[model samples]
Target chain A: MSLSGLNSLYREVILDHSEHPHHKKNLKQATSKVTLKNPTCGDVINLELNLVDGKIADIGFTGEGCTISQSSASMMTDVVLGKTTEDGLEMAQIFSEMVMGQKRSAADLKKLGDAAILSSVMQFPARIKCATLCWWALRKSLGENVDD
Target chain B: MDSKFLKIRNDFPILNQKINNERLVYLDNAATSQKPQAVIDEIVRYYQNDNANTHRSVHTLGERATEEYEAARGKVQRFINAKESREIIFTQGTTDSLNLVASTYGEENISAGDEIVVSYMEHHSNLIPWQQLALRKHAILKYIELTNDGRLDMDDAQKKITDKTKVVAIAHVSNVLGVTNDIKKMAQIAHIHNAVMVIDGAQAVPNQPVDVQALDADFYAFSGHKMLGPMGIGVLYGKNNLLNKMSPYQYGGEMINFVEKYQSTWADIPWKFEAGTQNVAGAIGLGKAIDYLTEIGMQNIANYEQKLVEYALPKLLNIPEITVYGPHSPKLHNGVISFNLKGLHPHDLATALDMDGVAVRAGHHCAQPLMKYLNVVATARASFYIYNTVDDVDQLIYAIQDAKEFFKV
Candidate 1:
């Protein structure tokens, strides 16, 4: 009856971010707006990226979903806002790998910013999609084909 | 009345399993009940011996298949006490059945400025079709609010259902709130307005014996899976006169009475609605499920589950900080209790219970409007059925207490 796997999926930081999300609104006059939804579970993500000189100038989002989805959106906005498009895409890739419980080192996830708290979600296989939904959309908004 | 059935704990094979290496205590009957061996055997027997396309071929097996399918229709008619067997149409499920009525019947009769009334407690399947139908036909969609105890506000229900209302569709029971609605009164109100009443019997038919004629409902919909049958089969029972007046939902080979170079006429009531090849095995399974229920007696099953709910509610309420939703008594509600442990998120609580081999649903139960009305993101639900016992509720309480201690919530 050990929920060691489940506790990691809903860590304290994730709950805190879900309760008080940063950059959770519509960005006024933002450059790019993209919407994605997990049709399976009805988790939605709306990403508005403000681009400045090919790097992320600002970012924001608003949607409804489970705690994994909401917190992941919060942490994803914090991570990709100030980074260049290439670096942002790279960070999204690493975060995706981390959530899937892939064998990626700390250095591999060092660039994911506050989203790294979700690294333990890899162990709980069912929640990987919830943790990576926002990161997947952010990468697509930045113009890379999000195959996963 | 048989001891084998009374002591039929071993009849359900799914109950003898382990999930994540823990014994399974299934509590999601409102979502879909676990099938017994008789239902499964009926499906297997159909595919093994009598598998044939119904109502088309002239061969011996085809005739038998067609007869069995039609007999199943009669079984359904008698199960719900519908006056005519032709009024029952096989559908994909409750969602598909409700959509069929909204799309085919509602499309033709409803027009601009007309109104369709539904309650806030309706499942998404019952709500969205009418909403879309209203939007498309330039009609208005009205909602019946709830009182503090989560029962439908009868005053609000009466006030909103007026002469302009063309259809009053509501659930016979709320899956999330566990409240059994007064469909007889609702049907009376709809008739007063010259509106058709559509009943969502998905939750009600499984838990109780329903008489559509007594309710005076124009249309009633229910699914097979929730009633201890196979999935992918549901029933839409309409008053024969109304069904005869309505148009066919889909067009295909089976539903046509006559086709010519220019014009064609659809088949009779139920066949006209069932356009394609129906789910034959699923129908047989549902028929077997109905037979099983008859053997145990629906009244007895309902009484047993009500007692279980009555027993469980007090134990759940005694938990110091837990917040139980819906009516506090089983007499005021169906056999369902949705609640939230003091500080534990529903998903977390469900996961914790899963570790202890207790299964419960932890979501909005497809009634997001009710969830929003309750002002919670999600709540854990434990629904009871005939197989559940007082000891099972005790095990559930112990498991919740264990989860509470482990999570310190």
Candidate 2:
């Protein structure tokens, strides 16, 4: 397989984030926490989000799963941190659409960085859920509509 | 064996397919075997011509379907050497079969303080039902330990089967370890303890010819798909007396003998356990599968698979990082070889092999306790069957080598 577009999916940046995820601890002082799991493959992620002024001030996750699931959560935290709640939700929608093989115009996916690697994952249908677990957890914490 | 049997490879259409542009090398027979054209054709014929509910109506289709269903039961009875056709009951599979016994027979007979003895190498199908049965009955569940080499410690098993033991359920062969248990001896032990011996023959019956009466087993369960038949058809064989004594698992049509406003009576031994309208096409397909196995001769299939296992074992062991679980000698193990490549996750290895046209099973093998005992998160298993040749083993070896080089693991 060509490494050009897919490299970012397993990039060292993502691997590093997965190996040592940031904010991967239980936050007793956090405003919202949600546990999300991909039941089909047993990939679980526990996300604790600190929401202040309707913005994600901090986010952390801890769980055991494949590299894709772990890295997806790490990348999610990087993209969502410092973004307004509305922007976070909007970004998740675009990411979800991208993973589902929907043709999202480049403008719809702004500054997603390595998150674009997941777009290639659309060709391989099985890994789509792994790429979307973190986003689903975030949407759940934000009280946004999320299925499973 | 039928030396005149048409090229067996031709019967399995999937075997001709190419994966990553290479011919598919299927070595996941223990998980589920590839179906032959005969079995598939029979299933299709059933749906196309003889699809109807069994034992219900006076219609010709219903009578033909019922005959096919009962004929499949007879095949199971003869295959396992059960004393009578009444001893055989069709189930969903081995899992459902075990659950049937645990739910109906266990619920009826077992009481609090009773003990159930099982082995550590059991599949989850064999393990979880007893665990649930123990919980429901307030009984104790005990496991017989394995030796360092994964063989059942018969001494430990003997010690575990005590006077209070009501059930001794064990697997005929470990799906993960591939170690064949001395089920006959175990049945004798159960008899000594006055406990009902239930054998999970999911792994064994597919490979070996079984005689339940010779083994003196009280209950035996196996699935059809693993034996190259259609899915949704499984056999649960129990002694007629025991089956008659037990309650029906599900209350539904076809299993009833009579019904009144305030009273109801269940049908005879096997039908009582088969409450609902069973999988008609699946049973017919399974009957055809049994005929296929018999025509090829079980002894020949077993011998051929044993040779393949023998050829594969040493070649697999020669790999530096490869760690093969189960018996070192093929004689001690079934046709399965569960192994792990050092530093390569099973899923990654399996995916890599998929690219090379080598299909393997990469997971817990539905035996978590065995996985825990193996001290690994998961394993990649390559299981062989009669259709598999030395070339398939070579392909698996080549694929593992490629994976090692590709992943540098």
Candidate 3:
């Protein structure tokens, strides 16, 4: 109970997003949809995005997973809605880099919106994949030039 | 903690350590048991004193190596009460042994319309090989359903196994559910249908006493590392008559009697199955592990674990919002418990528990069929062995509660 590492890893904000995830239903009329699975832990996400011209007009996700993954997906939908696909992919890179322990500038940190609290996920090496599941799906769905 | 387990755990050096500033509470026995110091020292002694290629030389070290290697086979033969040492083949692990049967015996016996029966509770290792075999031979694959309490339904089993059934493979104990199937009665049913019986004993051999003769299993397979032994060493117990007739799965050195340019004759029953260089040190270490367990007695180990489950299962059921899979009574199964905290995912729960220096497995447990049968995506598992104590279970319960509170479930 006194483990400070656990406290930061499961912060209040992250738990809130996980419990009450945003855009948690199926986007049946989506323009682009992609499914990703973490075969090791069986966490899966079906990411649906509505691209109007060059912007993500709407976003939603449906999946079953641990708190870190579900909440990460939830927070991602809130951050990427109404943003250009370019901005969404850029935000994903900044978010991935931040969680991977790369030094992020203040501007890049600000782009993550509410997901910046998940930077402590790096401390638990086993859970980094759980934290990055949605971002990968987004990058894949948008057909971005990801350096994965 | 039981008085017997206190001394039993002392044999393992890795258990007497700490992780993240807390004593390690290892409840991951179903994944793999910790190695005893005796098994470790035996592995080291082989390298230090008797290190040489076995069965192909006349030098002193070579002779010593061959003696110890085949002596290890004798130990395994005695461990499972096989008819002869030749009936026990050295395999890389349980998956390898089961695959050998599926490839060799299955290929020879299965016709285009033949049937292979497997239970719903089987691990992927036991399920996939026969699945591929059925696909390859154009045969039929049938499954026996599970009962409400997670045990195999005998009525369903009888109905599924029929005249077209040429083979039946089953898990001796479910890795996820912890229910021990009555393979003795199952073997009888398979025999009545003129079918062969194969038992996947990977989970059972580690916790209970298994006698293939008593079970009448045509082929029994298990991994050594699960039973306080080293990795890379396992045993396949096949009846000599059946093994003598089946074709070799893998063809290479040490497994053949004569190799012509076009044709080759096999060496013998077990050697024909074990190709290339085997895990000599691992086999010796596994033998030493058997010696360690034999000294403790497998029956005593089973009895003690049953008591541990009887003590722990009820308390776990008492937790709010906790959903446990498998039999409610401990006497009906071994010491494997799979449960879930309603709203929290197993991965998050396992990570939180790890922060408290507790280690348990969280996943589909390589038994997705059983997971589907139980109606869940995944679950958290806490499995016990001879080295585990009641105190470990207490800490696990406490850690689970902490996870529940942290997630505000």
lDDT of 2 by residue, B1-409 (tens): 4333326777899899987677788899998999999999999888888888888778998888888888888888888889999988899999999999999889988899999999888988999999998998899999999999899999998899999999999999889898889999999999988999999999999998899999998999999999999888899999888888888899888888999989899998878878777888888899999999998888888887787788999999899899999789878877988998886657657767877888898778887788778777678899988778777888888888877765556
Instruction: Mark the regions of model 3 whose C-alpha exceeds 4 Å error after superposition.
Output: A1-3, A144-148
- Place model 3 in a CAPRI quality band: medium
lDDT: which is higher, 1 or 2? Answer: 1
The stretch of ten residues in a row with the least summed lDDT in candidate 1 chain B is B1-10
lDDT against the true structure, per candidate, is 0.86, 0.84, 0.90
The positional error of residue B343 in candidate 3, measured at the CA in angstroms, is 1.7
lDDT per residue as tens, model 3, A1-148: 4345588888888889998999998876789888889888888899999899989988899988988998899989998999998898899999999988999998888888888888999988899999999999999889964443
TM-score of each: 0.90, 0.90, 0.97
TM-score of candidate 1's chain B against its reference?
0.98
Task: Point to the candidate with the largest TM-score.
Answer: 3
Clashing pairs in 1: none
True contacts kept of each: 0.17, 0.00, 0.64
Candidate 1: segments with Cα more than 4 A from true spot: A2-67, A70-81, A101-107, A113-119, A140-148, B1-6
Model 3 chain B poorest ten-residue lDDT run:
B1-10
